[model samples]
Target: MLRTDYKPQSIRQSGQLLQRHSSRGFRWAFTGTIIGILLVILSFNSGSLADSHASQLSTEKNKISAEPAQQQLSADKAKASIKKLPRMNIELPPDTDGRLSQDQTDIADEYENAFPRRALPLSIETSLYDESADDENPNTLTAVTVQAGDSLARIFQKQSIPARDLQNIMSLGKPVKALTKMMPGTVIEFVRDRQNTLIQIRYPLDETDTLIIDKKASGYHSKIDQVKVETELVSVNGVINDSLFLSGKAAGLSDNLIMQLAGIFGWDIDFVLDIRKGDRFTVVYEKRYAAGEFLGNGAIVAAEFVNQGKSFRAVQFVDDKGNRNYFTPEGYSMRKAFLRAPLNFLYVSSGFKRKRFHPILKRVKAHRGIDYRAPKGTPVYAAGDGKVIRSGYNKYNGNYVFIKHGEKYVTKYLHFSRRKVRTGQRVKQGQTIGYVGMTGLAEAPHLHYEFLVNGVHRNPRTVKLPQARPIDKKHRTLFTASTRSLIARLDLEDRIYLAQLDRINRQQAALSNSEISPKSAPQ
Candidate 1:
């Protein structure tokens, strides 16, 4: 009835140990072996022992392939259950270029992560969300560049902006009126909502200044925002090759800075009449910057102009009153009492002569003053600070303005298209008093300027001009202390030039020495 005990080696070893221990009891061990042999013979005939052995061998050999069928059946049931679930085909909003924008991508990522795919909601939408969710206005800034012949009203109309809004903005007066006169290439930015109501506007006043206008609860409010710009000292040395303007351009000075340079020395040296070849100049000025970007050039800090072998140096200084002006090292004002030419005219059409035939009178008469030909509407300025003694119309002289500078000098301007000053009005030097035009007694648009001394006509160009006020004694110390460093900076140009020349000379000397050494070597 005993089943198979499958430990054959242990059973054999146990039998040997029994034989060793029970050597005297061989009869009993032999009898037990005979009984075990008889039992094994009976078990071999019966198939139960062989079946148990085969089952053990088959399980050990097929261990990798063998698994419970119930687990696989459960997996199949799970797949079937998942397939029975509802399939969802969600439609997304059309993208501009067949690809999602950054906003859409962010929304998609959030939706994908927040809800499970199998348990997705009926629909998840992202199109209605604002592109800039954090911004209160959530409006895009639209840029409108001013083109030629474009007006503020025209731009607004072209962009479909409201005319009433422009009118309301203009009602704010002169400060807002500046936007109407923006030149071509100026860019104006407008921020508007979906309804196209202007939320904000920005116009660049200059490189570092932006005029900002925003819609407020009460009304529209405007303010100027100035970016911090760094100022750096710069210097340029240029010699006259052909013309002062060209030389200034070669020196890397812009047109505005060149005009400023000429103005600094214009009192003493006339750029048109007196500037000659070989004249040289050195300018130390300000270079402005903001956030490592070059904004533009600033004022002339100090300058030296050598005209006709005469050297003149001017240093820019600010007084205790915060008034800035250029002066010589000896504290003399660079500005003169009168400018050479009141208007920046094209040329002197007719020089002051003793006798000449009048173009309009058609008779030989003494032409006592210089006539400056310029475009109509060119602004004519006062030559010196004075009170307007006479301002009226005449048959011989169209629109005239006469200014009496003290008791000694009286200046007259004739043939103006318009007059800006009134009689007995005090006007500063260089103040625009009228515009050039061809009216009564003039064949063309020109300014007939006259300089009178003691009520007698004198040459406007050759007359000696009065000197401007010098540095006041009270402010001399402040001006002197401020100009020392600027003077040194001006002098640095010459020092640097001399150092370059010295370096070149030394290199030439070294080259000559090397050549002479080869020639004079021992043979």
Candidate 2:
């Protein structure tokens, strides 16, 4: 502690102290600079890593966005290929499970066995004839040809058969009345065994076929094989102006086809009254054939009718339950409870009225009947099923006829051109009774029609008709089954047609939007 103010005396000592302090400060500064440099590098590296991660996320988002587009493009290409492919035409087998195999074999065998393999030898022919003559049994084959107006009963009578056997055979089902209705020009063959009993009875049902009945211990058994034919689609179009029959003829359609069309729309519209001019219609239907020969038109598969600017379309279809009913897009039945007119007639001239001027009497009188206007000689039809009660001429009414329909219904027709039916004659619904003429005190050529319920006159135009009975409970099951199949068939046809239309529309849209040249389109 002596001489406390004394500073360092040696320069070297002062220099050493200064150098040590500088070194320590320099070390601390160096450490701080190194830490700052490391922090800067770490910040740059972290920023670079974040940028890479962002870029990878952006690339993943882009791929995800393009995946749906790529899939859609692939699907479009597949659809194009499918559209370009040829349509497949599959022909189903004639028989589903070889039902005709046995029949076919039997037919072939019968043809092969038509003639005996060996004829009787001349040496044995004399012995056979002598043995046959000595024996009580007759060995002969009789062939009978059916002529016009000849029936099975007449043929049997000619053959001298026992009446008791005929009666027994007829009692099985239908009597000779049913069998006698057979067409003429058919041949029948009978073969007798050694016991003189009928061994076989064969007859030609038609020109190309024959049916055989064989005697058995259980009675008689017969085999009948019907020939089925394939049919093709036929399309027809027409415009109805006057009558359905005339329109069908003009359109090159058959009467049966016209009737079927009327039946299809009968439930919704009355063909007798609702038909108007310019009503157009188109039908795609089927025709039946047998052995490459035309039979007739079968049914209407699809149809379109444009009536008074309104269009109605229907497709034949069978459903799962087999209930056949024409429906709208919403599945509403087209059929109502009853038909508008039982007899689809022409036009109505005079309607029902309480008081009307009599044409002949020239005075106001009660008009109880509906008058239909038609050309003279136009046939009049029966409104319903009934029996003819009266057919005669009168002073006020020219040539008239009265028909008793059911227990509670009666109808009358007056001023006819002529009477074709007689009293006590059974008439069916829509049966033509006579022509239209001014035979009575009518102003013009017209038909006077009347409907009576329990002998009281009713307004024919406004009368409320009774509904047809529904299917019987016993037949409901069968009806439902059959209807479902038919409905399904109709539905399939409709779907196919709609799909075809959609494809056409899509093709048209593509043609409008695409850059493909018109020459590339299918011709």
Model 1, TM vs. native: 0.62
Q: On residues 477-520, what C-alpha lDDT tens digit does candidate 2 reach at each position?
A: 55455455445554565466567768989999998888665576
Residue 21 miss distance in model 1 (angstroms) = 77
Window of ten residues with lowest summed lDDT in model 2: 114-123
| Alpha-carbon local distance difference test for all models | 0.84, 0.70
Model 1: residue 223 alpha-carbon error in angstroms: 2.1
Output the lDDT of residue 393, model 2: 96
Q: CA shift at 244, candidate 2, in angstroms?
A: 2.7
* lDDT of candidate 1 at residue 461, scale 0 to 100: 82
lDDT of 2: 0.70
